[model samples]
Target chain A: MNSSSVAARGTVRVGPSGRYAWIALTAPLAIVLLLFLVVPILSLLRASFFEGDRSFNASGVSLEHYLRFLTDSYYLNVMLDTLGYGLATALLCLVLGFPTGYALARAKPHWRRWGLIIIILPLTLSLVIVVFGWLVVLGRQGLVNQVLVFTGLIDKPIRLLFNSPAVIIVLAQQFLPFMVLSVMSVVGHIDPTLEQASANLRANRWTTFRKVIVPLSLPGILSGLTLVFVLSVSAFITPRLIGGHRVQMLGSLIYEQIIVLLNWPFGAAMSAVLFTVTLTITLIVNKWLKSHPG
Target chain B: MQTRRTFLVSTVAAGAVLAAPAIVRAKPFDNVTLTLNGFGGDFDRIMKETVADPLKAETGLDVTYAPGGSSAAVAKTIATPDNPPFDIVLCDSPSVPELIKADMIDPVTPDKVPNVANLLPGLPEFGQHGVPFMISSSVITYNTEETQTPIASYADLARPDLEGRVALFNLENTGGVLYLLAMAEANGGGIDNIDPAFAALERIKPNIVTLTSSTVSLIQLFEQREATAGALWNGRVFAMQNAGQPMAMVAPSEGIYSLMSYYNPIKGTKHPEAVATYLNKALSDEAIGAIANFFRYGPTTTVDLPKAVADTIITFGPEGRAKIKTLDWTKIAEKRSGWIERFNRTMA
Candidate 1:
C-alpha cells in the first residue's frame, strides 16, 4: 500500500483522531439518552423518595411509600407473583423454543426462512390484537370450549382464562420468538462436525446434545432467559386482560397508582422497586453467564 | 349640486360612523380556540353535534376535543400544573374534589357562566368548583338472555344462582366505588363504616367472573354470555339496550348512587372567558336536551325532554331524581386511597 493509504488507515483505526471522530458521531445519541432515559429515571427515583398524597404535591423526602409497599403482605405477594410469572414464562419459552430453535438451525435454508417467518409473525401483530386473539381462544364459549363440548369432553364450557397460568402462557407465546432467535443464532454458529465426530465415536444423539450442544449454547440460553424474564415481569396488558383482577403484577399496580389513583409518589416507589428487582436479577444472571462462559 | 370630492368625503364619514359600534360590539372570545378532554366514541360525536359545533357556528369559538377517560385527564393535569393539556376537562364526580384540592381547576360562579342559574337545585352542591353537566347512576345491569332470575336489587347479585356470571368494575372506576358505597349502605354500613361492604363483597366473590376497569370488557363479557349481571352505569346499559344487546337496567330497590360528570376549567387556562362561554353553550337547553335524548343521561340544567327520553333516564324529573341517594363525595375522595387498598386486599 502507498504511504498515504497507510496513513489514512491508521487515522481511521482507534488512534487519537479516530477516538474523537467516534465521540463526535455518538454524542447526539448520548445526549438524547441522557435527556430521555437517564433524566426521567432519576426523576422517578426522586419521586419515590417523597411522601405525597392523592395529588402530585410532594410533602418532603421520606421513605414512607417504600415502607408501605415493603411492609404490606399484599404488595410483597404481588412482587413475588410478578417474579414467579417471569420465571414461569421464561421456563415455558425455553421448553418450547429450544427444540424449535434447534430444528430451525438444522433445517435446510429455504425451510429455515419459512420457520423464522412463522416465529416472527406474531411479533408483527399489535399486542392488543394478540391478547384479544388469545381471549377468543381461551374465553368461555371460545373455540377450545366449543371443540371440547362437541366431543362430549364436558357438559359445559370450562373456565380457561383469568388466571396466572393463562397469563404466563400468553406471555410465553408473546416472547417466544426472542428465545428462539437467541438460541438459533448461537446453535447455528456451532459446528456440525462436532456432532458428526461424536456420533462417529458411538456417542448417542441425546448424549451429544446434553454434553456438547447445551454447554456450548449456554450464552444463548442465558440471554434468552434474561430477555423473556424481563419482558414477562414488565408485561401489564396480558396480565390485565387474561389474568383479570385475580392477578396483580407490579407493572399493573404502578399503572393503577399513577393513572387510576393519581398517587405518583407511591407509583414511583413501586416502579423503583420493580426496576431494582429486575436489575438485580439481570446483573446476577449476567455475572453467572460471564463466569460460566460458553 | 355638490362637488365630487366633497360628496366622497361625506360618504366616507357616514360609513365610519356606522361601522364604529359594530367593531366595539364584537364578541370578546370570538375566533378563539380551546382544547378540552372528553370521552371518545359516541359521546364525542354527540357532544360535537350538540355543543361544540353549534357554539363554533354561533360565536366563532372553536373547541378541539382530546378524547380520554376522566381520571387520565386529571392525571395529566396533575403532572403539569403550569401547562395543562386541556383548557376544559370533562371529569367524573370524584375528580372534582381532587382538582379543587390541588387548585388545578378554576372555580365557577354564576357571573362567569350565566347558564349556571338554570342548573338543577342541589346539582352544584357536589361540584362547586366546576359545572355539573350530566348525571348517570350505578344501576343493576343484567343480561336478559343469560340471567335466569330477574335482578331487582343489589342483594340479588350475591345469590347462588348468579355464581360465575357477574362482571364487576374494579375500585379504579367511579361506578365501582359507587357500587361499593351502595353495598355498604344497603348492608347496614356506610362510608364511615365500610366493613360491611367488604363482607358483602366476600359473599358476592363467587359470583364475580372478572373485575375490570373497561366498559368494553363488560360489554364483551355480556356478549360472550360469560357474565349475566353486575353493577354498571345507566347510560352504558341504555346504549347496550339500544344496540339490542339483551341487556336490562333498573334503579336498585336500595337506591342508586349518582355518577356525575363535570366541565372543569383548568386553573392556568389562557382563556377563562372562552372557557366560560364554552360551558355556557354546553349547558344551554338545546345542548342539554340533545345530550339527554341521545345518551339517556339526566341533564344538569332544567331542560324539558320528551316523555320517552325522560322515562328512560332514571335520574330525570323530580320523581326520578328522588330515587338518587346522594353520596358524600368529599368523604369518598378523602377515604378513596384507603378504600382502594382495602378493596385490593379483599379481592386479592
Candidate 2:
C-alpha cells in the first residue's frame, strides 16, 4: 500500500475513532438517565430521609420515616397486600394471555394482526377511562347485573364492583396486552416443525405444548411477569377506583401521604421501599432467567 | 451651561407631571394582565362572568384564570413562593395554615379590600392574609327514587334500613374527614377523639356501598344505583338535582361543617393592588350573589340574593346559617395522615 493510504488506515484504527462511535451511541441515553431517572431518584431518596411534618427539614436528616414503616404493622400489611395483589394480577394475566397469544401465533396473518389489534386496543385508553368503563359494566345496577336479573339468575343485583376481585379483573384487563404481546413475540418465532416433530414422537397436544412450546416461551413469560408485576405494584388508580375503601395498596397509601396529607418524608420513604422491592424482585427474576437460559 | 440644562430638564419634568392625570384618565388598566388560580368547569364560567369580567371592566386590568386543585395550587405556591405562578389563588381555609407557614401569601388590609368588613361574624380572619369568598358545606344526599325514608341524621346511616345503601366519602376528602368528625361528635366523642367515629364507621361499614373521593364517583354511585345515599357536597347535590337526578340534599340533624373557599394574593406579586381590588370585587354583592347562585354556596358577604336563589343555599335559613360547625383545620392537617391510614385499615 502507498504511504498515504497506510497512514489513513492507521488513523481509522485509533482509539478516538472507536471511542467516538461508543459515545455517539450512548451519550443521549446517558444524559436522559442522569437527568430524568438518576437525579430524581437520588432526590427522592434524600427527601425520604428528611424530617417532615407539614414541612420538610432543610438542615438535617433522620430515619424516623423509614423506622415508621418497619414498626407500623399497618404499613407492613399494605406492602404485603401490594405484593400479593401484584402477584395475583401477574398470574391472571399469564394464564389468560398465554392462550390468546398462542392462538394469535398459530392463526393466519390477517387473523393474527386483527387479534393483536383487538387485544391491545384497551392499552391505548387511559387507566381512568378504562376504570370508568368497568364501573358502567360492574356497578350494582350495571350491565352484568341487569343481564343476570333479566335472565332470572337472581332476585337482586349482586355487589360486584368496589372489591379486590374487581381490582384484579381491571388490573388483569389493563396488563393482559403486555403479557400477550410479549408471549406472542416469543411464540411467533417458534418453529412449527418442532411442534410437528413432538407430535410425530407420539406426544399429545397438551404434552407438546407443555414440553416444547412452554419452554420456548419461558423468556416471554418471565418478561411479561416482570412487567405486569411491577406495573401492578406501582398502580394507584385501579386499587383506588375499583377496590374503593375495601382495599388499601401501598401505592394508594403513598398517594395519601404525599398528596392528601402533604407528608413528603413518609411518602418518599414508602416509595423508596416500593422501588427497592420492585427492583430486587425484577433483578432476581432476571438473574433467574439468565441462569436458567430459558 | 448648567443653568440652561437644568431649566430644560425642569420644564420637561413639569410638563410630564401636568400631563400625568390625563394619561391616567386615558388608559386605566395600562394593559396589565392579572393571573388568578381558580376551579374549572361551571365554576370557572360563573367566576369569569360574575367576578373576573366586572373586575376587569372596573379596574381596566385584564384577567386570566388558571384552574387546578387547591392542594396542587398550594404545592405550586410552596414550590415557588418567591415567584408565585399566579397573582391570586382561591384556596380552602384548611390550607391557610400551611400557606402561612410556608410564607406563600401576602396579608390583606382594610384599606385594600373594603369588603372584608362585610364578611359573616363567625368566619375566619387570617390577619387579612386570606379572605373567605364563599362557604360550601358537606351534607348527606339521597337518591329519592331509591331511598324510601329520608336520611334525617348521621345516626340514620348505622340503621339496618340503610344497610348496603349508603356511600361515604373516603378520608382523603375534606368532606369525608368532616363526616368522620361529625359522626364522632354524634357518637359521644369529638374531633379530638375520633375512635368513636371509627366504631361508628365500622357499624355502618356494611351499609357503605363504597367510599368515594370525588364528585364524579359520588354521582356515578347514585346514577348506577350502587349507593342510594352518599356523603356529598351540597353544591354537587344541587348540580345533580338540576341535572334531573332523583337526588335530595339534606342538612343532617347532627349538623354539617362549613368548607370555606378563600382568595389570597400570592406572595411577591407585582400587581398587589389589582389583586386586592379583584378580591374586593369578588366579595361584592353582585359577584357574591352570582357565585352563590352558581355553586349553591353561601356568600361570605351579606349579599341580598333573590329569594328563590336564597332558598337553595344552605346558609340562607332564618337562623342565619349559625348551625354550621367547623373543626380545627390545623389539627386536622397535622393528624390527617395517621387518621387516613387508620381509616384505610378499618374501612371495609
Candidate 3:
C-alpha cells in the first residue's frame, strides 16, 4: 500500500479491517463482562423466578415474591422513598458541584491539582468511617448543636442524626466528588473564548453562564446526575447508619432479605426490580441526551 | 571394591539417621489444619491465646481462625455445602436450630470430645449436634452519667422522661429477638402470641431513637451519649464498663434472656479428627476459664471462676441460671422473618 493508504489505515475508520480490529481489541473485555456481569445477572434473574428457597426448587417456578413486593404498600413506599432520596441527592450534588467544578476548570494548574486532591480525599477513606464521622458531627451534642447552643440559638441540643434530612445530606456528601469530577472533565474541554464572545455581545455574567456555559456543559451535567442518582439509590450503609429506624430505604431492605434474613429468592426478586428500574431510567436519559445534543 | 557386609552396614546406618527424626517428630493428625469461624476482634484474640495455640501444641494439627458473625457463617455454609469454607463454625443459640434443620453440622458426641460431659446440665438437652462453649445473657445497659433514673424493668423503657433516648436493636440480631421475647413474656404474651410484644414496642416507640444490628454502632451511640439506655449483650456491656466508660448493666425484673454459643463441626469436614481434638481443647478448663475471665461470659464447662467474676456473670451459678428464661428456638427461627418485618413496620 502507498504511504497515504498506510496512514489512513493506521487511523481508525469504518471498514472491514477496522471493524475486525475493533472486535479483536474489545474481545478480552467482552469475555470478562460476559463472565462476571452478564452470567451473574442471568443467574440472579433465574433465582428471582424460583418458587422456593435457592437450595430447593421442587415447588416449581413462580413470581410470588415479585407479586408480594408489588402488592405490599410498605414495600411500594420504600421504593418511592429510595427514588425520592436519589433525586434529592442528585439535585443537591449538582447545585454544590457545578460551581466547584467550574472554578477548578478555570483555576491555575497547581491550584486545580490541589482542588482535585481535596475533592477526592474523602473517596480514599472507607465509607463506614465517613459515615461514623458524620454521626459524630451530627449527633445531639455534636458540633452543629454545640455551635447553635453556644450562639444562643437554642437552649437545648436537638436531635440532628437519625432522620431523612441527615441521610440525604450524608449521601450527597459521599457522592459529591463523582458529580464534580464528571462536570470538571467536560467543562475543561469547553472553549473559554465562547464565554468571552458572549460577554462581548452585551450579555451579562449570569446570562452568559446560563445560555452558553450550561448548554455547553450539558453532557457533564447529565452524566453527573445519572451517576449520583444511581449510586444514591443503591447505597445501604449510609442510610442505615444515619437514617436509623425512622428512614427505611429499599437498599437496606434488600440487604436484610439477602444477608440478614437469608431469603435468597425474595432478595433476588427485589434486586431484579431495582436493576430493571435503574437500567430503564439510564436508557431514557441517554436517549434524551442523544436527541438534544449540545 | 567394597565388601557386601560393609556396604549393608553403612546403608543401614544412614537409614537409621534419616528415620530417627521422623520417629521423634511423629504426632497424631500432624500436618492437618482446620479453619474455625469465630467472633472477630477481642474474642478471636482471646481464643487464639487460650484455645487455638494450646490445641496446636497438644496436637500437631493447626487451627486457623476466620472471624465473622454466626449468621454469616451459616449463610456461607449453606452457599457452599459440599466444600464449606470453615471446617468448624461458632454460632449462637438462634443459629443452632437453623443449622440443625439444614443438617449442615455433624453430631458432636461424648465419644469424640470427653469435655462435653462437663458442660452445664440441661445444655445437652438444647442440642447434641454441637458443643456449647460460652453463655451470655441479654440485659439492659445504660450510660450511668446520662441516665437520670435507674432502669429496673424492661417496661421502664417506655417512661415519658426517657423519650427519644433509647437505642434499640433491630430484629435481625439475636439480642434483638431475645428482647422482643422478653418484652412479650413481660407483657401478657409469650413467643407463640407476639401481639403483646408489638403493643409494647408501640408504647416504647416514642422513646426509640435508633434501631441497628451492629454492636459497634451501639457502643458508639453509648459513647457519644446518643443513647442513654437500651438492651445489649452482657459481655459487650462489661467490656465497655471495664474500659472505664460509665456504663452499667441490670438484669431486669422480667428475667434475663440467656444465650448459648456453640462450636459446631461441619458435616463434611475433611478433618473430623482434628475438629474433635480442637473442640476438646476449646472446652477444657484452661480455655473456658480464659474466655470467662476476658469476656466475663459464663463458661459452659464446670470451670471455677472467682466469686467477683462469677457474681458479675448472670448465668454463672444454678441460681443465676434459674433466672434465665428459655424460649423455644425452633419457633423463634420459624417466625423470625415475619417478626422482623412487623417490627420494622411497627418501629417505622
Candidate 4:
C-alpha cells in the first residue's frame, strides 16, 4: 500500500521543478529563441514606428509608417487580395483534402504509408522549382498551350499564366497537405466503430459521415483551416511567381519594404499588421472551435 | 498513444517552423572557414587568386566569399556599423544608397588612395566614399536569325512582328525595371508619361515567353535561340557572339541602365589600407581586363577598347553616351512604390 502511494506520487507532475527541467532541457533552444526569434521580432516592432534618418530611441517614434500602409489603396487592395486567396485556399483544401484524407485513412496499412508519401510529394519538391515548373507549363510557349493547340481544344491559349486564380490554385495545391495532415491525424485517432455504429443504426454512409465523422473532425478541420489560411496569407513565392506581380500578397509587400526599398520600419509595421490580423483570425477560429461542440 | 506522439511531434515541429528564419543564415559565407566578402561567382575566384590568397599568405586571414542575392545582404552589414564582417565587398549600384543611408562606407579621402584620379570625372555617386572599380550597361540585343533590320532603337523592342516572341526580364531585380524605365525615357515617356508605353507594353505582354530572374539565363536565352529580341548587356552579348551565337547588340536610340560596380570600405574594417590597395589594383588596366573577361562587362578605364569590340557596345561611342539618359536614383527611390504599382497594374 505504501509503495503504491509512493509510485502514485512519482507519477504526479512536479510543478516548478518540472518547468525548470523543461527550461533546462530546452535551454539551448530558449537561448536561440531569445537572441534570434525574440530580439528580431522586438526589433521589428520597434522599427514599425520609425522611417529613414529617424531615431527609435526616445525622440523618433511616429505613426506615419503605419498610416502609410493604412492609407495606401494599393497595399490595402493587396491585403484584401491575400485574404481572399487564403480563404479560397482553406475552402479548397477542406473540400479536396477531406476525400484524400478519407482515402488514405481507409487504405490498408502498406497503402496508407505509400499514400502518405505520395500526398507529401509536393512538399518534398522545393517551392522555387515548383513555381518555376508551373511557370513553364503555364507560360505563353508552355507545354499546356502546345498540347491544347495540337488538340484544338480552343482557338487560342487561355491566359492561365498569371492571374489571381493561378495564385489560388497554386496555393491550394501547396497547402492541401496541411489540411489533410491535420484532419487525417485526428481521423486516425477516432474509433472506426463509432462510424460503423452510426451506419449500422439505419443511417446512410453520407449521414454517418455528416453526423459522426464530420462532427468529430470539426475541431481538426477548424485548426487546419486557420493554419492554411495564415500560411496562404503570408506565402510570398507562389503569389509573386505564379501571379506575375498581379496577386500581390502582404508577404511580398513586406519583402519589398524590407529588402527592396530598405524601409525597415514600414516593413516591420506591415509584418506587425500581418501578425495581428492572422492571430486575430486564428484566435477567433480557436474560440469557434471551442464553443461549438465537435 | 499515437495521438500523444503526434501532438508532441507537431508541437516540436511548430517550434522549429517558428525558429527557422532565426537559425539558418544561408551558410553565412560559403565553403572556406575564413570568408572574403565580395560578390560571389567568378569575381570571388579572381579576388581569391589575386587578393585573398596574398592577404592570407601575408596575414594568415582565413577567407571565403558570398554572392549578393539582393542589396539587403550588404544593407544589413552597413546598418550595424560594427566590426564589418566582410573583409572586402563588391556591391552593385542599388547598394550605394543603403550604405550611404547608414554612413557605413569609410570616407576614403584623396590622401588615402591616390589612384582615385583614375575614376572617370563626376562618376562615383558616393563622393570619396567608395572605390570605383567596374562598370557595365545593358545594350539592346536581337536574334540574327529572326530579325532582318538593325535593332538600333528602344522603339524597335515594341515592334508588332516580334509580338509573342518577346522576353521579359525578372521584375525582382533592379536591372530589369531600370532597363524598362530607360526604354520609357527613350520613347519620350518619363515616369509620369509611362502610361501609353505601358499600354503598348500590355500589347507586347503575350509575346513574353520567359521572365528570367537570372541575368546569365537572360543571356543564355540568346545563345539557345529561345528568345528573339531582348535587352541584354554588351558583355553578355559579346560573350555569346564570341561563343558562336549569332546575336547582335543595338546602341539604344535612347539609353541603357549602367551598373557601376565598386568596392566600398566598410566603416571599422581592420584593413582599410588593404582595401585601398585592392581597389587600386582593380581599377588598373590589367585587373580591369581580368574583370572584363570574367563578367564580359566593359572596363571603367579610359583606355579604348579594340575597334571590333567598341563597335558592338552602345556605350562605346561619345555620341551613344550623350544620348543615354541617366536615372536620378533619388527620384526613382522616392516614388518607386508608385512606379511599381503602375507597372504591376499595366505589365500583366
Candidate 5:
C-alpha cells in the first residue's frame, strides 16, 4: 500500500516490455500476405483500371477492360468454357472418387491402406510431372497409340493430347485424391451400426446403402464436391497443358491475363470473379446439404 | 454469420498486406543482396560465374542465384510486390508483354547498360522494356542415327515414313504455331492458314509420338530414339550434339521459330544498379562466349569469336537460316484459343 510498493506493482503489471515480439510476428505474416497474395492481387486490380502501357491514370479509374471482357465473345466463351469444364471435372471426380472412397472406408484395413496410398500417390508428385506422364502415353502416336497401331487397332494414330477429354480426365485424376480423402474422412467417421441396424430391420443392402449410408455421408459428399469444384475451377496447369489453349479454364485465363498478359487489374477482376463463383457454389452446396439433413 | 469466416480471413490478409510496406527488416550493408533469377541447370552455373562472380568480386554483394525456369515464374514474382525474391530477372521474348502489362519490370534506359548495343538487330521490336540477352530458337533437330534419308523440311516429316516417329512440344507456345504457320505458308496457306497446317500434321498424326511442354521430354524422347525427329530449341540440339548424342541441328528449310531471350531487372529491386551491372556482364563477350560454350547456343555479343567458338554459333548469316521460320507471335497470340479448340476437337 506504500507509494514505493505501488510503483513496483505497476512495473510488474507490464513486465518486460519490448517491440521485437510484435515486429517478429507481424513482419513474417505481413511479408507472406503482401508478397504472396495482396501485392499480386492489388497490382492485378490496379492494372485492370488501365490499359496497355500508359502509366495508371492519376485522374481516375475506368472500366475499359471489364467492358472489353464482357463485350467480347471470345472472352465470354473463354469464361463459359472454364465454368463448363470445371463443373464437368467436379462431377466426374464425384462419380469416380465417391465409390473409391466408400470402398476404402469400408474395406479391410490393409486393403484400405493400399487404396489410400494409390489414391494419394499423385497428390505427392508435382502436377507438371503427372501431366507430362499422361502426355507421353495419351499423345498422338504415343505409347498407347503405338501399341494399338502395332496390334492393328486402326489404320491411323489418333490425336489425344490437347482436348476437353484430356482436360476432364486429368482434372478428375488430379483432384480425385481431394475428393476421396474428404469423403473418406466423413464416411470413416460414420457409425457402421447405422447401416447394419437398417439391415437388421430387414432393409436390403442396396436399400441400407441408399437410405442410411448415402444420407449419412451427405456432409462428406458436399465437402468433396466443394473441394473438387473449387480446385477444378482454379486449375491452371491441367487446362494449360492438357486442355491446351483451346479449353480456356478460369485458372488459365487468370494466368493468361495476369502472368502472361501482365494485365494485373484485369486478372485481379477475373480472380475476384473466380473466387466469388467458387465461394457461391460451395455455399449453395452446403446449404443444400443442410436442408436435406444428410 | 456465413460470411464471418471469409470476412475474417480477408480482414487478416488485408491488414497483413497493409503492414508489409513498412517491414524492411534490415540485414547488413555491403550485404547488397543481388538475386539473379534465370534458367536452371548448367545455365545456373554460367550465371553464377559470368554475372554473379564479377559483381560479387567488385561490390561485396550477397548474390544469390534462383534457378527458376520459364517466363511465367519470373513475371509472377515481379508482379507480386515491390520486394520480390528476385532482383534481376532474365526472361525470354514472349514474357515482355506480361511484364509490361503488370508494369512489374521497369524499362531500362540503354544508358544503364550501354553494352546492350551488341545484341542482335531485331531485339528492339521483341523487347521494348528490357534488354536482349541471347537468342534461342525452336529448330528441327533429328538423331542422325535414326533416319537414313536427309530430313530437310517440316513437309518431309509429313511423310508416312515419319508417322508415329516424331516428338513435339505441345501446342501451347508460339514456337509450335510458328512452325505450323511456316508449314501453312509452304502449303500455300499463309499465317492465319491453320487448316493446311493441320492437314499437313494430320498426314503424319501418328508420327507425333508425344506432345510435351518441357524441353527435357523432347530430348529424352530423342535420346531414347522413341522418336526420330523433334522440334526443339537450337540450344538443345547443339547441346545434345556436343554431348555426343548423334543429333543434327537443322535451321530447317521453313526457318527457325525463336524467342529472343531478354534480361529483365524486376521493379522494386533496391539493387537495380547491381542487377543492371550483372546484365551487362552477362552480355559481355567473355561471359556470352562462356555461356554459349556451356549451353551450345550462339553468343549474343557481336564479337568475333575464336575458331573453336565458331563451331557452336547458329548464325542467321546472309541467307539468314532462310528456310527456318520466325513466328508471327501477334497473330498466333490472337488465334491461339481458336486454333487450340479446333486442334483439340479434330485431333483429340
Candidate 6:
C-alpha cells in the first residue's frame, strides 16, 4: 500500500503508535498514582504485619492483627455493619434521590436552579457541621419532638438520635446530593422525545418512567450507587458524631485503633481489610453492570 | 481631638508600664514561637483563655496551640523524636509513662518551673520530667431534676430506673478508663484485674445511652433530658451545672478516681526557656484560679481557692486525698489496648 493509505489504516486501527501516544499522555498521572496512592497503600500493607504501636521491628512481622480480626466475632460484626450500612445508604439514596433528580431535570429554569441549590447545599457545608446540625435537629428535645409535643401528638419526646435509624437518615442526607447530581446529569442528557413517544403510545406516567426513563438512566443510577456506597463505607464523621457509641462503622473502628489506642499495626491491618472489601465490592458492581448493560 | 489624643497617649503609657516586666523577660526569646499541643473542646478554650493568652501577653512568645488527644500527640512526637512538632504537650497521667518510655520529653526542674514547688503532694511526680497541670476526678453525674433517686455510686449507673438513659465515656478517654477503674474497684476489683469492670460494664449495657467522646453530646444528653445520669469528670459536671443544667456529681462511696493531667516540654524544642516560662505561668495562682472558675478542675498548685470554687474542685484535701484511687501508669500503658478491645467487645 501507499504511504497515505497505510497512514489512514493506521489511524483507523489506532495501532501500536497510538498506544504509545496514549501511554505518554497518561504517564505523568500514572506516576503520580503510583507514588501517592499505590506506594502508600503498599507501605500500609507492609506496616500492618509489624507488631506494637508505631515501632515496627522487622523480626516481629506477623499476621497477628489480621488473625485477631478474623478470629474475633466482634470485628466480624463491625465488618458486617459497615457493609450493611453502606448498602442501606446506597439504596436509600437511590429511592429518595431519583425522583428529586428527575423532577429537577424536568422543571422550569428558575425552579430547577433553586431546587438544585437546595439539594447541593449540604455539599457546601463541612461534614462535622452537617452532623452537628443533625444532632440538634434529631436530639430527644429537637425540633421534631418539640413540634410533636406542642401539637399534642405525643406526651413525651422519643429517642431519635444515636441509633441505627439516625445513622441511616444522616448518611442519606449527607450523600443525597451526590446521587441527585449524578442521576440528573444522565437524565438531562436523554432526548425528551423518548418520553413523548412513550406517552403517544398510551403508556401511563408510571409505566413510562419504569420502561423508558429508568432504563435510560441506569448508567447514572449505577454510577451514583457506586459513589454513594464507597463514600458511605468510608464515612467516619457522621456516625462518630450522631451515631455516638451506639453505632460503630469500620471507619470509626480504624480511627479508634489508630488514633485512640495508638495501635498503628492493627489500625493499618483494619484499613487494609476495608480497602480490599471496598475494592472487591466496587469491582463486582462494575462487572455486573458491564455484563448486563441496559 | 485633643481629648481623644490624650486618652490614646495615656492608654499607650499605661500599657507600656504594665508590659515592661514581660517585655524585659521576653527580650531573650523575642523571635521564638512555641507550639503547644493539648486536648480540644472546652479544655482548649480554657487553656487559651487562662494559659496561652496570658503567657503571650506577659512573655511575648508567639504560642500556637494544636488541639489533639494525648495518644495521638505522643504518637506524632515519637514519630519525629529529634524534631518534634510541639514544644510542649499536655497529656493525661496515663500517657506520661509512654512518653517517658519513648524519651520524648525533657525533665522539668524546680529551677526551670518554680511553681512546681507549689504542686499538691502525692500527685504524679515525674521528678523534673513533667509537672501537673490540673486534677480531675471522675464522678457519676446526674440531672437532679430528672431522676427521683440520687445516684450514690458508680454501680448506680446500671439501676433499672436509669435504663436507656445514661451516657458513659468511651474506653479510650483518660477519664473513661478511670471510670472503668472506679467501677472495678466498686465491684471488688481494680485496674490490675479489669474483668469485673468489663462484667459491670456489660451489666449496664441496657442503661448505656451511648459511650461518647464528645463533651457537648454528654451535656446535651442531660440538657435534653435524654440521659438522666452517667459517668463524667467532676469538672464537666460543674460545667453542666454552670450552664444551668441542674446537674450534680456524686463521688462514689467506694472511692473516686482522679486524673492528674500533666504537661511536659518536648526534648527538641527550640525555645526550651520559653517553654519553661509558659509552663510556670500555667501553674501560677491566678491562672489556676481562672481554670478552676471556668472548668472546676482542682489546681495542682497550693493556691488557696475561694470556698465557692473550692467546694467544687477535687483535690488532696485530707479526706479527698485518701479517697483518690492510685493507678499504675506503666501497667495501664501496657494493657490499655487489650482493655479497649474488651470494652468494645462487651459494648458491641
User: What TM value does the first chain of each candidate achieve?
Assistant: 0.92, 0.91, 0.92, 0.88, 0.78, 0.86
- Model 1 Cα shift for residue A163 (angstroms): 1.4
- Every candidate's lDDT: 0.87, 0.84, 0.87, 0.70, 0.71, 0.82
lDDT of 4 at B145: 83
Per residue, candidate 6 scores C-alpha lDDT tens digits across B14-89 of 9999999866775555677888786777777777787777766766677777886677787788767878889988
- Highest TM-score against the true fold, candidate: 3
Q: Number of clashing pairs, model 5?
A: 17
Query: What is the CAPRI rating of model 5's predicted complex?
Result: incorrect
Q: Write the per-residue lDDT of candidate 3 for residues A1-294, one digit (tens) a residue.
A: 676797687854467776678789999999999999999899878878888654432246899999989999999999999999999999999999999999999999999999999999999999989999999999887999999999999999988999999999999999999999989998999999999999999999999999999999998999999999999999999989999988899999988888777788898899899888989999988998898877
Q: Taking the tens digit of each residue's C-alpha lDDT, what string does model 1 give over B1-348?
A: 899999999999999999997886576567689998979998888889988888776677788999867788888887899899999998888888888878888778889889999999877755458888889888898988777779998878999999998888888888889888888998899989998889989999988988988777777777777788998888888888888899988888878688788999899788888898888888899888887898888888899998988888888889888888887787888888898888888886
Q: In candidate 1, which residue ranges exceed 4 Å CA deviation?
A: A1-15, A105-118, B1-33, B59-62
Model 2 TM-score, all chains together: 0.88
A best-first ranking of the candidates according to their lDDT comes to 3, 1, 2, 6, 5, 4
Q: Order candidates by TM-score, high to low.
A: 3, 1, 2, 6, 4, 5
Task: Output the TM-score of candidate 5.
Answer: 0.71
Clashing pairs in model 2, backbone N/Cα/C closer than 3 A:
A246-B348, B164-B207
DockQ of 4: 0.14
Task: For model 4, state the Cα shift of residue A177 in Å.
Answer: 2.9
Question: For candidate 1, what is the DockQ-based docking class?
Answer: medium
For all predicted structures, in order, the TM-scores are: 0.91, 0.88, 0.93, 0.80, 0.71, 0.88
* Candidate 1 chain B weakest lDDT stretch, 10 residues: B22-31
Off by over 4 Å in 3: A1-19, A53-59, A150-152, B1-31
Q: Please give, for residues A174-262, the per-residue lDDT of candidate 2 as tens digits.
A: 99999998899889999999999999999999999899999999989999999999999999988988888878799988877777677
Tens-digit lDDT string for candidate 2 (B137-188): 8888888887788887777888788888898788877888888888889878
Judging by DockQ against the true structure, name the best candidate: 3
**TM-score, cand. 4:** 0.80
CA RMSD per model (angstroms): 4.0, 5.7, 2.9, 12.9, 14.1, 6.4
Per-residue lDDT of A102 in model 2:
84
Alpha-carbon deviation at A263 in model 3, angstroms: 1.3
